[model samples]
Target: MDGCTGKIEQEMRAGLRAFFTVPYLLDQGMACLEEKLREALLFGRLTVLHYRAFGGTGAGIYRAAAAVEFMILSLDIIDDLQDKDNQETVWGRLSPDIALNIALGMLTLSQHLLLTADFPHERSGSAARLMNEQVLAAINGQTVDLLNNIESEEEYMEMIRLKSAGLLAAACLTGTLLATGEPLSEVRTYAEELGIAAQMKNDIRDVLNWDNKNDFWNRKKTLPTLYLLQSISDEQRWIADYFAERLQLADVVNRKEEIERIMEESGTLLYSSVRMRTHYYNYLDLVGKISLAPEWKEQILAMAD
Candidate 1:
């Protein structure tokens, strides 16, 4: 997402600064998570940006034809177990173990006050269960996302809701746990809404999703395709079928140009963004309903900075 919702950004930053200021709780949880996952290979672990610890996840996918093809080509199940030199490597390098560890750490840290987590919920839990849920949610979400290509727009949104917002919901629940020790129902609602906003932010980054480098170039089903499917102009629908046939191609540049014209002429990108922002606004309004102190609620609101 290009910018945080100013309100959410303010609110979360304050809550985080306050919550982190407290001794040990956040750190202890994170330590456990790291120790758990570090033994496994972590993908996309570049240093330019630190993981947000929460929000819709974007990196865990084979987004290009080549990337998908690489997996298909590397089908020697024996290769992962027996290293070229050590035969007993016991690691896929991308083992679930590592993601588990990282996710666990995130859940633990999410619990602390972060600035008094009352307004929402999810304040109490056995640390282990919380972490376990985080990893499970991530994996489940990913599974549905992969299945989305074959689903309708409605199903696609559901996948995005799971894969992308599931953890974001966890983030709020964690915050609630640290703040008040309650069931996450209330907090989860807030999270579900915020999840929509977060996804909208992602759509902005995918400005190219409808462009020549469209995410659909890899056959990844996204919001635009669904909307198009729902209200496609004759010209765009004709072009979409053509795009589908080339989903696995090595080159999508030419197709992208054609789609770009269709997207522009049809106003798909703008329409998608408008819809996305509408979700964000709805999420923000949900946050506004929480019962926390004005300042605390405002702090949460400020986070969309």
Candidate 2:
């Protein structure tokens, strides 16, 4: 791990140790948290990177990154629980009630850490408010996603902006606010675009895979799947039927090869790739406008890769 990420992890462990005093809570929470820590701490890294890029100094920034990461882990647990996917995870293996309690505890812990971070009083308050607003927006977006009522590309874009992009914006803005005491609008814009691009990449992966989390199997209306549904020929009517629930998984489970071929020949994959690239390029353009040193700017741009 990067040195900054290591610091954030240490901070997160410290926070858990300080707050989760109950024996049962400590055991279960630590297990779930360790699972999350094993993955790339992307949000925490973003917070630390932005803090340095905007001239922040000292160890306080690591606490802020830990707070952001805690909130992210809470949401990840909730998402997996709601989706009933990724049952191999530690949280997934536990009873739902226990996992839910741990998630709620982490959520509160995140706010507590942020509210008490060693920053200026006024700056800490501002950052806390921004974090709450973004989290609420993400919750609303997640509600819409659970309903799965999206009918157009526009709705899908809006949902992702609120659900996925809001979290990234909050991470970047938290560091910027702590460093400069101002929520930089340019930073939020680029972070949101980057988040959308990242979601597109995940959607592409999910649509191609054959598993419990496969987007097509779940009838998820992602950009690629939406395009496939809209542009499929008469011979591919079964794809639309499966999405509409007129056909069951059993009817198409053995047709993965055919579906992959159709996704390629119908230009669905290319279309999705183009859309993801468009957002990424836009994010890069916005990144170029930020006033940072050449080396810092390069480092920020390299994150997209």
Candidate 3:
């Protein structure tokens, strides 16, 4: 890890140790924290990057990053539990009740860390409010996603805006609010664009996977899946039948290669790629409009990658 990310991870570990008093909870929290630390701390890095980009100088910014990471970790566990996927994750392997309790505790700890960070009272309040608002928006989005009733590209976009974009926006806005005591509208716009692009990329990958997480297997109405459904030939009607529940997984278990070929031939992948690229470029364009040094802009762009 880079120096900044290493510092953020250190702070995250400290926060877990300081707040989790019960031995069992501490062990579980630490296990989940280590699991998350194995990957890039993208959201936490966004918080720190924005803080630095906005001229924040306090050491408490690391604490703020920790808070962001803790909240994200909690939400990730909740998402996996809700989806009943990612069974290899530490939380997924634990008892559902234990995992749920760990998630709840970490969530509250995130708020505590944020509210208690060494910032001006007004800045802390503003940051907390922004964080809570975005978190609530994410929860609402996740609720809509769980219902699995999205039927249009517009609905899918809206759901992802709330579920995915909201978290990214919150991470950026937290740092901005802590530094400037005002939420930067430009930061929000670019962050949301980035979030949408990232989620679309994930959707494309999920649709291609031949596992429980496969969007087609789950009948998920992602943009790519919707496109596939709309563009399939009569010979590919079995795909539609499976989605509509007229056919079952048994009917298509051995057709993975055929389905992949269909996805490629139907222009579904290209369409999804083009749409994802549009949002990604929009994010870069919006970031360019922000009043920052060229190097800062470059750094932010690198972080997105």
User: Candidate 2 versus the native: TM-score?
Assistant: 0.97
Residue 214 local lDDT, model 1: 41
Residue 120, model 2: Cα distance from true site in angstroms: 0.9
TM-score for candidate 1, residues paired by index: 0.56
Candidate 2, number of clashes: 0
Model 3, 1-305: lDDT tens digits are: 24877888888888888878899989998999999999989998889889888988868988898899989999999999999978999999999999999999888888888899989989988888888887899999999889887788999999999989889989999988888888999999999999999999999999998778999888888999999999999988988899889999988888889889999999999999999999999999999999999988998899777
Q: Write the per-residue lDDT of candidate 1 for residues 1-305, one digit (tens) a residue.
A: 23222223233234334434534534532343233233311111110011122222332111111111111112112222222222222223434344233333333333332212222222233322453465466556666654545447577667667655655565445434433444347667766666766775665456465544345554456677555555667655554664467334545446667666666667777888887778778768876776655655565555544
lDDT of 2 by residue, 1-305 (tens): 25987898898998889988998889989999899888878898888899899999888888889999999999989999998978999999999999998899888888888888889989988999998998899999999889886888998999999989889889999999999999999999999999999999999999988889999999988898889999999988999999999999999999999999999999999999999999999999999988999888888888788
Candidates sorted by lDDT, descending order?
Answer: 2, 3, 1
lDDT of 2: 0.91
What is each predicted model's overall lDDT from 0 to 1? 0.44, 0.91, 0.90
| Clash count list over all predictions | 30, 0, 0
**Which candidate would rank higher by TM-score, 1 or 3?**
3
lDDT of 3 at 98: 95
Who wins the lDDT comparison? 2
Q: Which whole-number lDDT from 0 to 100 does residue 277 have in model 1?
A: 79
Write down the TM-score for model 3.
Answer: 0.97
Give every collision pair in model 3.
none
